[model samples]
Target: MIIKTLVHIPLYNKATTIVRTLNSVFDQNYKDFDILIINDGSTDESLELVKNINHHRIIIHSQENKGVSATRNNAILFARENNYKRIAFLDGDDFWCSNHLSTLCALFDKFPEAHIAATNYQLKRSRKTIDTVLSNFESTEDQLLKSFFHHNYLNSIFTCSTLMIKPEIVDKTGLFNESLTHFEDIDWFVRIGMKSKIAFSFRVTAVIDEIADNRSDQVEMKYRKLPDFTDYEAEAKNHLGLEKYIDLNRFAIALAYRMENDIRNTTLYQQKINLKNLSLKQQQLLKMSSLQLKSLKRTQKVLGNLGLHLRAGD
Candidate 1:
């Protein structure tokens, strides 16, 4: 029998959460799907736990520590070879609600022209659940490229785990860029949006566990060491025809650099963007701040004390 959908999970050292993720997949209301768990060199007991699941529908592939992008690309290749019509992703540390797959499948059925389908999701941070909508728009709608660009910049509407796409679309759009250690999903979404329309559902049907040791946190630390926006800038102009928003992109990048205390690049990008909203004095203050490493640490400490936190885009 031909599988209707394939759920691709890229696993690492997620021994704590892998079982929950698999159980969520098995509990899905949509049953016409198979799972591909790509174990990316997890030193933990993640693989052993997965083997004990005793599910025929699950296929496990183990490879030496390739990054998330490469692991996902491997799953894409597997989906193609298996003749699956649709493909979805669920990370080892993340899980879907029972109706998540069914919701996306129904959206595809309703809007055959849409190559991509996404739903709302919740972020679980330190025992708090925050429900997030893709955009401020209505609950269900078919979004065009222009609308998507306007509503989002770097981060996508939904997280990677909440997205479903047709195999043909993947063929046309190509695989995820293995070079990008972060924001690969953003780059992939931008490419997909440029090629086809997207169907979105406002129902929160997935949960992202934003733990301290997650890849996003590590990526933020890496950004502090070295920040670069060349790839994003090229994608905005070359793929999405978002030349006008280049300055906006620069502004966002500048903010990221500022948060990282990389004031040199931040000031460079700020000057290049030259946003009019900031008064001259405010701009001067930003440019002239000492930006000492100790001061940045103190600022972070203050924010933590005040219960303020930062979340990555998407």
Candidate 2:
């Protein structure tokens, strides 16, 4: 049974949703794909569930807990080793729509020159759901890089589950930066966008389950240090280390302070940077942000301080 595409699901204690995630793949309308479950040091019943599944097409790799970047990198290598031409990613907690794989295969057939194709996602949280997709724009590398500087439109546009990429291109650009916790995908996408055009579909092909275990929220509460998220700040300081970017990070900290309505802390943070040095554009944006910060008031601060008791990233 030759595999045209390998769908990798990186799991880490996703006991609650692992079954649903795997089921989605098994239920796909497209059948040329194989499933590989990378157990990233999970201490839950996730492995037991995988063991119970009698599907020969499913492959499992159980190893000591490595971060998502390392696990994903291993997944890519696994796919390549199996002679797969295309690779796709689906988080253990997220599931793809039935047509998701079929659509991607068709798109690949039509656009052989495209190295990547990403679809929209349905963001689900509590009883609320929001559908997000990419807007019309030139998919050129330069255009995508310039767009990142303005805003992160790709967050909603391309999620882990909706992405399908050529194995060769991924090998050339290198794998996920295991050093990064947050923005790892963004960094990878930026590199990919630079190397080849990213074709996008407005169709909602995946459901991003935003449940109670968001990792980002845990980091914000000081419960744990998510190394990947820290890598961005570290790299900024180590590589570019531009004062402006540092200032931006500080400004973000200040915004966090403002969000908490800790005026004293906010002022202390503000003192670290020379307000006079801010570029006119940044200055204007900060000013507007400051006003919005005020509107959030003290109540929101209490809620944030209470903590996001659930999932970090959806």
Candidate 3:
């Protein structure tokens, strides 16, 4: 069958949650799509379980461990080489509601000029059992692009699992950066916003499965050495609100290092941000010493356990 929408999934040691994730795709209300699963050097039984599925609409491939950047870039190349018109992403540990694909298709139909369509998703944080979507804007093209960089990742408006893009976007925005440790999607989002019209829908149609035995969350932010968004300085200046977006990113990373007591790296990113771009609360915390920030973070963690959730990303 000619696949119009290629549902690309990348997997690595996701055996515990893989079946649930795949079933979410197989059960989509939108039917004109094909499944492409790339197993990236799993030490677990993820490969065997997938092989047992033996579904005709599903195509499976395996390779030695490469980071998510390589896996996603491979997915992009696969979509283009196979002549697929639209490509959607679903991480091996994430899931979709029945209407996830349908909603994306409808978004495209509603906005014919859109090269990208994204739906909001509920984040399932592991311990707190919190389920929420942090959407602060409407569906306008400008808002869709701005929603992503307007806040920190805790309040991010886009996830690969909720996005469907035309294959042509690859030519304009380029592949996902392999050098990025965790924010590869953020880097790609800026490029896509610069080159394409991003259409968005407020309806929630996906769940980010952090509650599962997720391997991706194993790494620490301090060890990863995230970028402070200086690379996009030129782009930030050209686009309205982009400078504040970059500043917020810098603040988030700097705060991460601050929480870890990595004073040198914290100062490195702190100097890169403009204090005016941050919220009053964030600005106040920025002035706190590393010890103060660590204590406050600990208090927040305790409160989270008690279900006294703060407004996310505030």
Which lDDT values do the candidates have, in the order given? Answer: 0.69, 0.63, 0.73
Please give the range of 10 consecutive residues that has the lowest summed lDDT in model 3. 305-314
Residue 23 of model 2, lDDT score: 90
**What lDDT is reached at residue 70 by model 1?**
90
Q: Estimate each model's TM-score.
A: 0.80, 0.72, 0.87
**TM-score of candidate 3 to 2 decimals:** 0.87
Model 2 segments more than 4 A misplaced: 133-155, 212-217, 221-314
Clashes of 1: 0
lDDT of 2 by residue, 1-314 (tens): 67789998888888888889899998899988888888888888889998899798888888897678788898888877879988889888888899899877777776677778777678775687755533335652312222222222223346677889888887556788776564456557545544565565666788877653533434542332222222234333333223333344344455555555557655555666556535454344344444575665632242232221122222
Between candidates 1 and 3, the one scoring higher on lDDT is 3
**Model 2 worst lDDT run, 10 consecutive residues:** 302-311
Let me know the TM-score candidate 1 reaches against the reference structure. Answer: 0.80
Q: Residue 76 in candidate 2 has what lDDT? A: 87
Instruction: State residue 215's C-alpha deviation in candidate 3, in Å.
Output: 4.1
Which has the higher TM-score value, candidate number 2 or candidate number 3? 3
Q: Write the per-residue lDDT of candidate 1 for residues 105-218, one digit (tens) a residue.
A: 998888888888888787776678776533235435544334565544323467789989887787677888777665566557656766677887778899887763454544
